[model samples]
Target: MAAVSPSPPAAASIDRGDSGLQAYARARLAEGDNALGLAVAGYRAALKQDPDRVEIARRSYVQALESGDGALALQSAALLDGAGMLPRDGTLLRIGDALARKDWQAASALTDRMTQEGNFSFLSAIVRSWIAVGQGNYAPPTIDAKDRFASLGQRYLDEHVAYQALNHRDLSAAIPAVRRALVARARDGAALRLTFAAQLAGIGARDEALMLLPADHANFNVARAAILRGRAKEQPFTPAQGYARLLARLAVDISSDPAGRALGLRLARMATFADPLGAEPHIVAARLLVEQDHAGAAVQEAAKVPAKNWFAPLAQAELIDALAASGNLAGALALARQQASVPGAEPERQVRLGRLLAESRDFDGAAAAFRAAQASYEPDKLPWTLLLFEGSALEQGKRWTEAREVLERAARIAPDEPAILNYLGYAQIERRQNVEAALELIKKASALKPDDAAIADSLGWAQFVTGNVAAAVPSLERAALGAPTDATINEHLGDALWTAGRRYEARYAWSAAAINAQGDVAARLAAKSEEGLKPEYAAP
Candidate 1:
């Protein structure tokens, strides 16, 4: 009792410790590597000594919850509560997590406690609404809570609740809620009103819905307005001009959003009957249809584009692809010829036409087209990738000798190219010659892109042919994992598994390949598997 410590120094020491703890906490949070884990560990250690540190405990609890440590989050939450500085957000997050896990009783109790606290009334009300929904209480949330939410800059919440009301088939309740939301933020909120208006029209409240939509909302673009005008016409065919304008505006709109693109396509389809000479609509319709995977419909729509338009050649190419995909080889070939004959066609068009011709089994015509294209431009001037197409076309035509010669030239020109190496190696493998050299080439390609499924399959196939069936399984498995949907890889994996004495797994894989394989490869694999025979499957 004789020696008393200086009060100022003791206070300074406590302040210094608090500052160090704060620094440690912030540093742990700022770190990128497992920040949540490090932060929780750092804060918990500091808080053990500085037990009254409310902010630190709150942050620690948040980090713990975010890192999915529920017990630790609860411990920190209790600590913050004891310290009398609990964050509203932390409580809400914890309650939400409990609700997500279907701990409704715990969530309800927590919400009741939060409501009694009176500090986070808005948040508590939102949670109560969600809890009521979870409990199958279909009644709309209290009006007082809705009004409080609207006052808190959360009008979207009102609209969202209205949408839920609509989902519950209570459009009458939804109408007033949505109208309130629109009134809160009209300029930036026109879209929501428009959507609600559409719903109201569906519910036989067309006059009321029309009254809600502003006559000249700034966000309403010409195309959308035209569509709305056309829809509002008394006579069914009276708004033909408006429909044409809508189709024209739609061509520009499709570039930005998929929904807009779809709407554009519909308007263009309608415009075709209204104005057949307007090629713009049909061209836009075809492109949008292609995007939607309606390739056959795309081909039909593209056929309506005027021949004088610059899009004619591009449209013909699309038709070629669509017809090819539909197994209409004759139609595809005809479209390819049309694309080739188009005046002043670009080099890409020529390449596309030649590829389509080769795809349709008109390899001779493809060869002539490729030869002409090659002659028209120097090798150094054209894209190096063009050589791959020309060489592969030669291979498909059974001009193996010419194919090999061209592929060899391409290999020399682009020695580090993975696709060239894989193609040439697979070509050599398919020819049943140069097995050792093909293995080496494919191994090199795999080293360059270890995760490339096609190259892995080729390496596995090469190993299988060289009688190293044991080494083939790992490579084939990797290939199958990387390209689970590829019929060729699945077929190869099946063969490798069959050779490895895994007959049951092999049969399952072979069945998958048979179901999904395309063209001649599909027919061959399906027939071979059905015959209970393990034939050599080559890579394409």
Candidate 2:
């Protein structure tokens, strides 16, 4: 991911002939250009004049890490440590460096510091285990049976322990750790299987390793194919790489949860420092950056994903969202179109395009893309949800005839789906077509999803449209009471009240509708409050 800039240096500071200030301005400009190499040099030079500027030093340290300048980063880390202002992730940086240099002594010291400072045990314990593995002294981290990521973490730890044991020719110890990691996540996480299988193969248990990766298992197919063709090799075993993988995965887990996102961002940045060539860390960082409303930075971060990386698809997906979040809908659409046009993936790629188009209100394009997604399926095997996707797109586009056919198809496929029933019934109610049948459909939907405000609204409106004003009054009242803030439901209630000759209460409902209504709906609600419903709109 690209290094993020803080802000442009002030104009007065430009080329001030004071070398430190000039270097600082240069550093800031380099950061703005996403040139971390130049930024690192500029910040390093500027820090000579004022190494204690917490802000500059911090920024310098960050750029060094982002640029994979280990020497520069460790130097900055010491500077920050001396000032007692080291950032939370600085310790991890120093630890990773120590492990990489094979200085297990220094790495142990760093881990001890993390433990003393009360870094989350879930993380620090795992880090300690890896440091021990690097030193050929394997100590399994204590398991937290309840930790959300414990299973995944142990799977990784067991891989390292097994790999190191294999190197030590201890088949008894290696075999158990290998079997445990393999069985713990047999159906997912290719990395675990790949790494463990490699250890067995290294120990000349080739047949047993092959047994762990059944070629027909969907999860193993890609790895199997790559291995067969000699195009892929299992990751080289190193405690440093294992540490990076753990950090990257943990960053993803934490960032995915809203409450943990703040710390997740820091871990993501540090993961990049840990694995400079990695793709996952960049994507995770980009996603969290976008959530924090830094879309431009996210775009830069995601764009750094190598085009040929296995995660290229995910990176592109992130780019589309980041572009859209930054209000570049046109760019988003363009990228979505390019991805959807890829030859093989079918439904997923096309569905992405359809959703993007639908969200942009280009329902015609959405309908077309969704239809294309169904081209791969046999008529009898069409997924009901995909049909509903296409139906809803057509419905929103005001193509009712097209929408009704597809939606009815979906309802047949999934007879108990209340949302499908409500959507189809309400649409028919709006057009006054087969009102009696539509009403029955809505009644069934309401029975299935008894408390859904929208379904209740549909049921009441269908009653009102069928000239059952007596029944509509109570039904509409129930719907309105259930969804007090729904403009459409309130308007329906207003219509029923006016038909029942309750003029004052009718106006009150109309006023309520107008409160949150917008565009033509708002105007119509306001007019109804003043002029009352037309006679034609009233039920007999």
Candidate 3:
């Protein structure tokens, strides 16, 4: 994401009288590299120079908000609004600008107009609530029962306003509100709990607050410990902070659904500027940026979360993901290791480290991390899952004896878990150990999870290894359908297809496997595609 060094615009385009073409070309290049901030800048400059270009102004408005360029968003949004072609999110930018300047009348007027629109009335309600706070007689918005978005609205947005309305003024109603929000699985679950607990402690009800957090849950464990130490206590949100929270959560929710993704991202970028110091907005923005494949922007957003914020640890996880996504695997691993080494780190932190290590193909290190997590956790907490993780890592590292022993322990603890059953059965079949028992285990697993691709693959491979070619083909085909891009499964399917006399189809399957295959697997897949299945390539 280097600065926009615009290559010379094509002479023909310049002669065509488009002066902004050079800037537009630079913006396109930045967009290709996922440098959203740089792209936004180029688009902004292009829009300024070519104010009549509605397309440029619209793109600038969206990119400006996506890049957290509040001023640029306002400029483009105003341009678009003046042209009478602004979208709902562009209007939101204008409204946010009004809110920032404390122009309550303008903000309220914009929000009221939004209420007349067919959708996003919930968002308008949030904006109106913020404006009301400024006017000194604030009344939170109520959810409209008959509205088409009532389910989604009541789920998260209205709960925040309701919680604020009841809990801010009447402390007695806080517990019920918190319970309802938690039960509804509010979008900002951890942050909501922290805020609720903080409000409890603020009124000398520390005991009640402590009781709300059970010792066993990972995030809650950290909160409980921190609360006891008189640390990580967030103060009550101001009107601005509350407004930001509602917008951020709503933005994330909207971005998750495909129909309104761009609008959501634009709104989220606005949320970041609304309360710059608030952790929730940055966390939401970072996560959304990561999902959108803008790793650089995600990293920048995650870094904005203050260390003292309760959401800092969660933000750090986002930072690690952003680093990994941006191809800085070593840096991501090093940071994960550093975080995992924090004194009295929770089991979840260790689990996260193990996951990162496993992704990096450092199986031995991943196994160690999973083992450490297992040791640190309470006796009944995800014990079998941790054992399965360590066992899989050991298997990948070729420490099969240890892997077998650990996997057996997991099987004993979770006798009916399909994953454990499939893993142990598949490992045994691959090793030519206890074929009859392994087949039974695989059969049971398939019965338990009939639609699981990996389980189907394992069962098919089990049949192939035992020389049941006719029985394996259907299961192998089913596995391939469920996991179209899985190289190993495709290779297995090719072997079965070749054995079943589908020569051309077998070659096609092998070619598919070769698409993303690497090293020894690539060589094997290529050989199978060219020479058909050899004795070495197929199961015995």
By TM-score, the best candidate is 3
Model 1 global lDDT (CA atoms, 0 to 1): 0.62
Model 2 poorest ten-residue lDDT run: 9-18
TM-scores, all candidates, are 0.47, 0.63, 0.83
Per-residue lDDT tens digits of candidate 3, residues 127-246?
Answer: 666677767766766667787777766766545664465435555555666687777755566666766676676655678778766565555655677778876445555555666776
lDDT tens per residue, model 1, 383-404: 5466777788888899988888
The TM-score of candidate 1 is 0.47
Off by over 4 Å in 1: 1-285, 322-328, 342-344, 517-540
| Candidate 2 Cα outliers beyond 4 Å, as residue runs | 1-119, 123-125, 136-240, 254-266, 375-382, 433-518, 529-540
Task: Assess each prediction's global lDDT (C-alpha) against the native.
Answer: 0.62, 0.75, 0.77
**How close to the true structure is residue 172 of candidate 2, measured as C-alpha lDDT?**
86
Best-to-worst order by lDDT is 3, 2, 1
Q: How accurate locally is residue 77 in candidate 3, as Cα lDDT from 0 to 100?
A: 77
